[model samples]
Target: MNRRIRSIFWLMTICIIAINAFQGYWLWKTYQINRQQFASTVQSALFQSLEDQQVGDAKRLFIRKQKADSSSRMVIHRFDSMGSRHVRVFVNNRSDSISRIRIESEQPKRIVVTYDTQKRTTGANPLPADSIAKRISSLVLLDWTDRKRVNLAKLKAAYRSELIRRDIDATFQLDTLTSKPQNSLGNFVFYRNGDQLTTDDIIQTSPVPINPIQNLFVQATFAAPELYLLRQMGWLLGGSLLLLILTTGCFLFMLSTIMRQKKLSEVKSDFINNMTHELKTPIATVTAAVEALQNFGALNDPQRTQTYLAISQTNLQRLSDLVEKVLNLAVEEKRELVLHPEPVHLADVTNELITNHRLKATKPVIFDTSISQDAIVVVDRVHFGNALNNLIDNAIKYSRDKVTIQLSFRGNIDNWQLTVSDNGLGVPKAYQSAIFDRFFRVPTGNLHPVKGFGLGLAYVRQVVERHGGTITVQSEPGKGSEFTVHLIRRD
Candidate 1:
């Protein structure tokens, strides 16, 4: 409500908002990076799949070409020391041999073939190395990009397996361009290596040429790359959100605490003002009566002396009651309230209190008693008696021209229930719970019509709770109010 508190509240609000905004922005950037990494991984898998498919095709093509040539024939010369066969091949029926070949079959699934082309002569009119390299590169590119020639089902299976090995699973559309790609663009392109037989001609009759091989592009469109990226960053996002929640919670708790402290400051000032006025009037009255007797020689007349003495006694008693209320509250707050339990007659105590209040009351008062006869309960006699008295006193002080009070005592199988009802200024529903808090008073404007510190109800609650009991209030603002005390019957 004050200017300084208001400013601090707004500043805290802005700070928390800024912190959350920064966290959100960081999370967004991380998501984008993950998306890029995911795309790269998919591209790598696709490139591997194309290479795998090409290698198998080249081997099949080489075997077919060797079978179609009639002039070149293979004859096993002899068995080598490594269990491989050394074979001589006469190409175009020339005695100056083109190459010597070796074939090794070690495993059922593997066959390695090698050629010795160093002894071949330029006299056989061999094709230039550049022409052979260029032709091989073109064939490889066409085989990779030609959609019909490519075995799509096998390629897809290989691609899926590669993705799984790298921990990626997503739906995608795989297509290839028949023309050579100019750039990578959005797709991944596969290029051949001329030095390695993986893409080059299998024949070693000429020196292999190093050339810039053209690439064939494979176009893959994923259904939801972002969703996959989000899955990857799930833990990071959750942690950020949790931290934001905790930060906001702490800010709210701090704000509420500040508000409560401010309200307590105002309440304490009001209590001091009320206490000063109350003490001042009683002290002034007792002082005046004592001074009159001593200075004016009022002792000469026995009646005058007695009257002045009674006035002094009455004001002094009021002062004693006021001071006791404050001291009781202070003692309870300093430490836990201590109680000495004893068995007492509840009905008798209630009757005695009603009698005392009726005798001392100046206004017209009516008492309605609905008490069970001889109801006994175990409790701290002194503190419990005072708690009852405070309730009765409050009922009387807040009443109209004429007062009507209803006091009841009852016993169940396990507990004793006592209620005090009065035709007084009842508490509002909102303040009913707060009335039992120390130093809290209903806002009655600047001038409080009633006198005394606001320690009565708080003390009553403390005493009741110390005895292992509970208290509750039910009231309407214009009508009357009822206070109930429930205490366990300790035998």
Candidate 2:
């Protein structure tokens, strides 16, 4: 797969695995914490119940101490043989009805109880205390020792505690304590002291039933939904980050590719331009030489032959110059061009190039030169002359009737400006920005076309830049173009 597809696949896979793992771990931790908290609450409630029972016992004992009665005694009961009993009695001096008592004992106890001036009895004669104790003992055995009844009571206590803890606001019509199934009317039976109590026996008491495990499950499930939501959100965030990175990478890659292509295009155009220039000048020189030879027999004279020979020699030299320029430009483009700078008078170089051009011109072209005799610059004479000649040739090719070539020196001794202006068709406004680009041509679509491969300005720019100078052009259509060269003057 491509890099983008592979990256996406791996990103999705990793996110899926990471999110799922994180959610699982988070949920498990929540569940464990919730379970521990629930267990803690249940234990607390059990201990609280025991404490409340102890407090109630203490309160009863204190009350009994305030009301002492000789005839009254406290009774204590123990449902299990292993349980203990305690008792205290209170007798009040001011009021007989104020008598109170407390008891703490393991076994059932009976006292001969009197209220104020009245003696209380449950049988024809006053029931013996020992007989009452025996009867209470039997009742306790029936309720507490019976396995089924003990289980039912335990279940009742546990269910009641759960309901209160859950704070269920509604009353349940069904039995709150029992594990038995209920009919539609919500009826059940319970055996207490060998007697059965039906639903009708305690219809007035309100019942609120709750399952503790179910409550825990509901709470966990409520938080459970958030797990999925968080996982999905994580996945979305991860995916978006991955997508952003991928998009940025792709954009950078495309930008790099475009820049490379543009550079290659410039190199290719430069090569084609240099190659055409290299070929055209030599071919033109050889063609001119052969044409002169064709006319040699018709003239049939030593002077004419010498003239033809000189023309051949000059054109041949032009071809040689063209070849050398191409080679130097190639080396420069590759960063291999070496400068051989020497002190040369600017006026002398200008005069030599002007003379060469005058001899080569088919039509009369005016030349103007103005410079201080002391004007000298440190530059590679050959390359500098080539650059100046390219500028002059471009001016002559585009001129209207006569070409005006002007050279002048201005600025301080350390800085010099060489201005070359021509009254020729100026560069168009639209093409001005790209005029120095290699092989860029202005399309006239005329029958008679200018002979050029469009490398002259590019060559001039390169040479000027190598000299630590800047070249700028100013022109308008149908007006003229002026090129200024700014360079450091040699001391």
Candidate 3:
């Protein structure tokens, strides 16, 4: 896939995975929290219920067994006091459940009783002695055979007796009394002077609820485990981001490398085509000149013979120059070329180059050397001479009528400048930048094109730069061109 699509795909995948992991962790934490809450609630309820049951049983034992006095004349009075104490203890300890205790003394003449309910103030008045005795007798006779019927009537009588004893004035009041299962403890309360007793069927509220602080602690403990998981997920996310950055960087590097290779391949192709044309032109010229010399009729005339010999020599030198330029370029490309620097007269070098190309010149050439006659530069003799010759030869080849070469020195003693200006067709402005590039030629559209591989100026530039120098061109369309070489003067 393309870079953008691939990046998006990985990003989406990472996001989805991260989201799922986070959600799963959250759900697991929530489940743990809920489970802890349920367990704590159940444990609290069981503990409260067990405590209430033990307290209720202890109160009943205190009333029925511990205070059962056998030899007391005021047995009823003592029993009544004991029952009130039992109720107080039951109320205090059994905070989670309802509890009550009643004690009745039976005598042939009178009946005495004391009762304590979990909740006081039943809103009633005291009952008569006969009615109170009857209620007590019914409770004492309670057994499995008629326990349900007797318990019901006993509770009703208790309510009437309590209302009469308390002397409650209200005409209408609620009576709430509840009976436990046959195997469980129950509580009873009377209202309206033992006229009625109300019983509740179910207890929905817990006697002792769970502590709020403990509940919060349990919740925090459950959440504590998730902290490490969250940290791990954060690390995973960070690693993914780093990986994404590295991958993007690698892709960009590969793309840049491919573009560079493509550009180099194009340059190599241009070099090959230009080299072939350059080599072929010199070979063709030499071959033609040799053929003219071999023809007996052309050699018969002294003038014609000399002309053919000179043409042959010129083409040979051109071929030799082409080979030398190629070899030098090869050495430079491999960074193996070395320069033999020596002091040389610039004027003598220029004159020798002119003499070498004199036969090949198609037009008359004029040399102007007005700046310095004894100008000496430390340079590689062979390469500098070749650079000067290449410029002069180009001027001669392109000029319509005459080629004018103006050589001058400029700058201070530390830095010297050698300038070669030619009055020939100027270089186009657009091609100036690439003119010295290997195998790059300006498109002149001349019907009879000048033979060149475009390597001459490139070679010249390489030589000048190697000598710690700079070369620049000044030209305008339809005007003459000037090439300037600046170098450090040898002390």
Candidate 4:
């Protein structure tokens, strides 16, 4: 039975460990999924923002060289020519960087037109339509040779303005669109998730005016907000953490239970060995006495025959008591021990127990008491006396020197705390907690001085508890031991 219980305990421990491992694996998988999903969602938002009409129109209008229909009214005021004038107009069309072209018009009369983006807004001071046209023409006269920094501030501002116009809430939306599209043909990057266009580039360039300028390799980096997955997969991540906590708790609980069961199994095995040792002496004595009366001439002499008979009877009774104690423990373990609680004076009970033990002891044993006010406690008188007898018996058996016993009743508001202390080869602190557990004993080495099944403390604990009380002990290896029973007082 002990082996089977140990096997079950180990199995339970392994199962708990496996469950924790599986949960950990699942949490890691969920993290990967969340990251993939965020990438997908952010990509989808970017594509949708690019397709926005306002964003598209803003790029188109920036490069619209006088609406296509108005191209028929050519000539920025008929060029005066000393001969037939050869005049050509060009617009600065480099979209990779800001226009830094040193605009120069050549025709024997040269004029340089330059503009700064920071000092003033382009359209704040309205210029003559033709004047604006000539300035733009001079910019393109250099054939878009401006390798200037692209001021993306205005374009990013326009992108957000459009997103707002489209009723796209950035809070709930991942459209962290901070860049303006340059060449309509900039290299594209795709993401694994989101609304659509999974095969799109991470850097998407909107349709800018078709220019003959070489497209410089541009890097468009898209970054999602921090802890985006933690926020987005809110419930999944939280549930994972909760699962881990529960798993850890179960693991610890199972580990503790398995350790306790293993200890209990060892203790119970030791109990059986001790019980066998205890029963062997009495059984051997009874058998020897019986042999002396029968096989020897002892029966022929009435005195000798009576002596053998008495020895056999005494040993047989001792054997009976040992077996009875074991059976009683079994009953207690099965929770089948019924109690008949009634009003009883704890002091009277203690005195009777001490007297019985003193008479039964093989050696002269001294008894002492510090009992206060014979307090009436509610308990089963018979079983309660039996419980105290176990304590006294243990006190006598484990005594290394002069055996001494003490009994006392310390009163609490609603209970009588009965204490049974003894001066004996005391218990070690390590084994103290297990002392009251069924079949547990402090390890006694080869000396094997005391002999009995380890059920006395267990029986005491059970009976005290059945009477709505508790039992505890305090002891040190060399000093002695004390058992305290807190039984409810009816008064």
TM-score winner among the candidates? 1
Better candidate by TM-score, 1 or 4: 1
Write candidate 3's Cα lDDT for 1-491 as tens digits.
24555575567557656755665676567556644553354334333333333234334443464246322111122212321211222212122322223322111112233443334243232223333334433433332123232122433343334434543211222222232224435332222223442333121112221111111000101223234333435655566556656655665566566555654565676667666777787688878877877866777788987887888788788889888877866777888447888878777887777677676666688877756557777889998888888877777776768778777777654588888888888888998888888767776543326776677898889889888899999987666788999998554
In model 2, which regions exceed 4 Å deviation? Answer: 1-324, 340-344, 368-370, 444-448, 488-491
lDDT string, candidate 1, 99-152, tens digits: 323323222122233434465443342233333233333444444345333355
lDDT of 1 at 341: 86
- After superposing candidate 3 on the true structure, give the runs of residues whose Cα lies further than 4 Å from its correct spot: 1-324, 351-360, 444-448, 489-491
lDDT of 4 by residue, 1-491 (tens): 56776687678778877887887788778778755654454444333433332223322332455555243222221122222122222233221212222212122123333343332222232223345435455444333345333334543554456545654323332222222234678644322132323324433333222112322222223434335545756797688778878877876787688778777677777877887888899989988988888888888999998888888889889998988877766675677778888778777888888778777689778888887554677778998898888988898888875888888777754756778898788898888888887777777674457776677788788788777788888997668899888766543
lDDT (tens digit, per residue) of candidate 2 on 365-484:
898777877888888899888889999998888878776777777865468899998878889888887778766666554322466656789988888888788999898988778899
Please report the TM-score between candidate 2 and the true structure. Answer: 0.43
Better of 3 and 4 by lDDT: 4
lDDT of model number 3:
0.55
lDDT of each: 0.69, 0.56, 0.55, 0.60
Tell me each candidate's RMSD, in Å, in order: 11.2, 18.6, 21.9, 13.1
Ordered by TM-score, highest first, the candidates read 1, 4, 3, 2
Query: How does residue 86 of candidate 1 score in lDDT?
Result: 31
lDDT of 2 at 73: 39
User: Best lDDT goes to which candidate?
Assistant: 1
